[model samples]
Target chain A: MIWQLDIMFLVLVVISAIASVNVKDLLSSAILLGAYSFLMCLLWIEMGAVDVAFTEAAVGAGISTAFFIGFIFQTTRRTKD
Target chain B: MKERYPDVTIETVCRLLIPPIQLFGLYVIAHGHYSPGGGFQGGCILGASFIMMFIAYDIGEVKRRMREKLNTILCATGVLIYAGIGILCLVLGANYLDYGILHQILPAYPAKARALGTFGIEIGVGITVMSVMISIFLNIGTAGEHEGEPE
Candidate 1:
């Protein structure tokens, strides 16, 4: 239970985190950030932190994504970095 | 320009799903003692339902259901409920948040009173969390353009 799916989600977390920072589009970056949160939540669940996992899924995946998109509407989507 | 879909599919689906999601959120908050969920999780889910409403339709639709005034009151009320419980316990000759003193008023054992107290605080947490999330989303969504201007 500890090590079974940990490695997979760990890799995913790293990938998504990096991708979120590297992406040029702010919207895409925001979505990637959400994906990172989701993968981290999965890892938390894998480790039996179900409460934390639920929080991450709700706040990270649900609310933050909406905030990001809403911010995008208010601001610009293009990113120089 | 905001994108608007002509079809009613999203609207129909969201209408059907919103009630169930809210019910489940309440259940999570109430059933936290017996299950893995608690106040925070349930509040977030409840907040998400409103957000889902926003995504499915327009902001006006959600505003009609949950007004800005009610939202503001909820944020303050939730925290008040939490602190009020602590104060009540203090007045009851116990330390802050000590629910054992609640047994005097309730007809249950100390342990049961404590459990009931815990549940009360969880409800407070749920209300505050749900309102805060919604408030943050609304503020950031409008970028303060809607602030100080009650409509």
Candidate 2:
């Protein structure tokens, strides 16, 4: 059962990471990146490293995503592709 | 503050959600010892609460509510607290974080002293993480790009 959850979360992570890179709208991509980080946090929990999971959730999901969104606010929200 | 956007329902919902989210973040921080969550996770959640406000309201309101100078101070102070604890241990002629000395000073359970010491450092890390996260957001969100968009 735990392995199933891991697999499911892994799938979501892959999807979010790919979408974060591929999405045209900058805000959406940033949101997706946050999603990816959230999933990675869950993965860390599953791996039994609460400290690492906490750090990842804090830095990756909270800080990095906000930074990306701030870039969008200061610049264009659209992409060439 | 700028005019609240003409979405009464959204505003109402956000007003209700903010308190609960913030409270949950606090709970996560406090109950970190016997649980999977900790200062960093709780701090991230706390930062998210502000970010949500920023998105729901506006940047100007966020700036007013959480001034940049205060956040900078919090970030720096958090690190100082952590480093101070480590240095205190060093001064006491032990390793970087010999919590036993702390126990000796506190005049209580030694193991509890260790736990409390760790908790203090974790709190410091949390504060730094929270403020740094907000700083990164403010910096990135407000930066001006070069005038080279593909027009």
| TM-score attained by chain A of model 2 | 0.89
**Cα error, candidate 1, residue B113 (Å):** 0.7
Best by lDDT: 1
The whole-model lDDT of each prediction reads: 0.87, 0.78
Q: For residues B1-151, what per-residue lDDT tens digits would candidate 1 score against the true structure?
A: 3556755998899999999999999999999998888999899999989888877886676777888889889989989999999999999999999999999998999999999999999999999988888878777776756534336
TM-score of chain A of each: 0.89, 0.89
Clash pairs (backbone) in predicted model 1: none
Every candidate's DockQ is 0.76, 0.53
What TM-score would each prediction reach against the true structure?
0.91, 0.78
| Model 2 stretches astray by more than 4 angstroms | A1-7, A45-63, A77-81, B1-6, B144-151
Poorly placed runs, candidate 1 (over 4 Å): A77-81, B1-6, B147-151
Query: Backbone clashes in each candidate structure, one number apiece?
Result: 0, 2
